[model samples]
Target: MFFDGTLWRDDAMIREGLGQTTGARMGHMSMCGREGSIAAHQFVLGRKVYIHMNNTNPVLRGCMPDQVGAWVINRHYYQHSIPMTDAAYMSRVGDPALRRT
Candidate 1:
């Protein structure tokens, strides 16, 4: 589950009971942003994956080699796994009548 926006993040409330609940083994959080926009404070608990995105945030300019520890598979990389043909992509973007029967 992805929890976005600052208003929704309740660390204590989330960790208070949900962390130890039955079948809840581990929780990981990833702050997907440019660079400076995604602060260290956001990733306070659990395993945090910081995604320094250039298009998403302007902070990516400040993200140095040290700040970015490793290269992880992002959404775009995984998206390639799903086969997309002209038929599928065109149908979604074009008029409904243009879609092949």
Candidate 2:
């Protein structure tokens, strides 16, 4: 599993297996809308996912009508989709109403 320490690293694959350096904290997303975060998601490759997002993470807002939707619909690669409210995940995970027909 890759553990990227930078919030926006140029190339995460390079540091995928290397151990953390002396002082490295986890990455975080602080952009206002989802465009920037969504771009980062698309930049990565292979079985991607997100984690430890703040409640206000852009994914929560569903703001990037173009990019975020593209990721959810076409790419199927949720690179930065964590910190979701229980209801949001449940809605997608279990609720029939949330699924596409």
Candidate 3:
């Protein structure tokens, strides 16, 4: 699973993972988004695995979460967007309606 740690409380995690060596934080939608897309492509093509994104992740920028998730699914890769607020409900209840995408 890929965790978008951009908004994590710890700067060290972001710095080491998403920041440049100069300590510059990368753009969430531009840098990390592309990384996530590439990862999706690789995993879907190479390992034939599914990829799920947390609702908090800003991977697709302006696109609606459900639309992107549907597109990913169409490509034979599973991409589900789970909202942070309803994450507990999903994990415990497994409600299909709670899924955003």
TM-score of each: 0.26, 0.24, 0.22
lDDT of 2 by residue, 1-101 (tens): 23222233322323443435311133344232353354546666786555333222334355567755544553233343443554466666665765433
Angstrom error of the Cα, residue 68, model 2: value is 18
lDDT at position 74, candidate 3: 46
Q: Lowest lDDT 10-mer window, candidate 1?
A: 1-10
lDDT rank order: 3, 2, 1
Enumerate clash totals for all models, in the order shown. 0, 0, 0
The global C-alpha lDDT for each of the candidates, from Candidate 1 onward, is 0.38, 0.41, 0.41
**Which portions of model 1 miss their true places by more than 4 Å?**
1-44, 51-56, 65-76, 82-101
Give the winner by TM-score: 1 or 3.
Answer: 1
Which candidate number has the best TM-score?
1
What's the CA RMSD for each of the models? Answer: 13.9, 14.5, 11.9
Higher-lDDT candidate among 2 and 3? 3
User: What lDDT tens digits, residue by residue, belong to model 3 across residues 1-101?
Assistant: 34233332223334446543221244332123344434435544333322333233354457788977764574444323334546766667656666554
C-alpha RMSD (angstroms) for model 2: 14.5
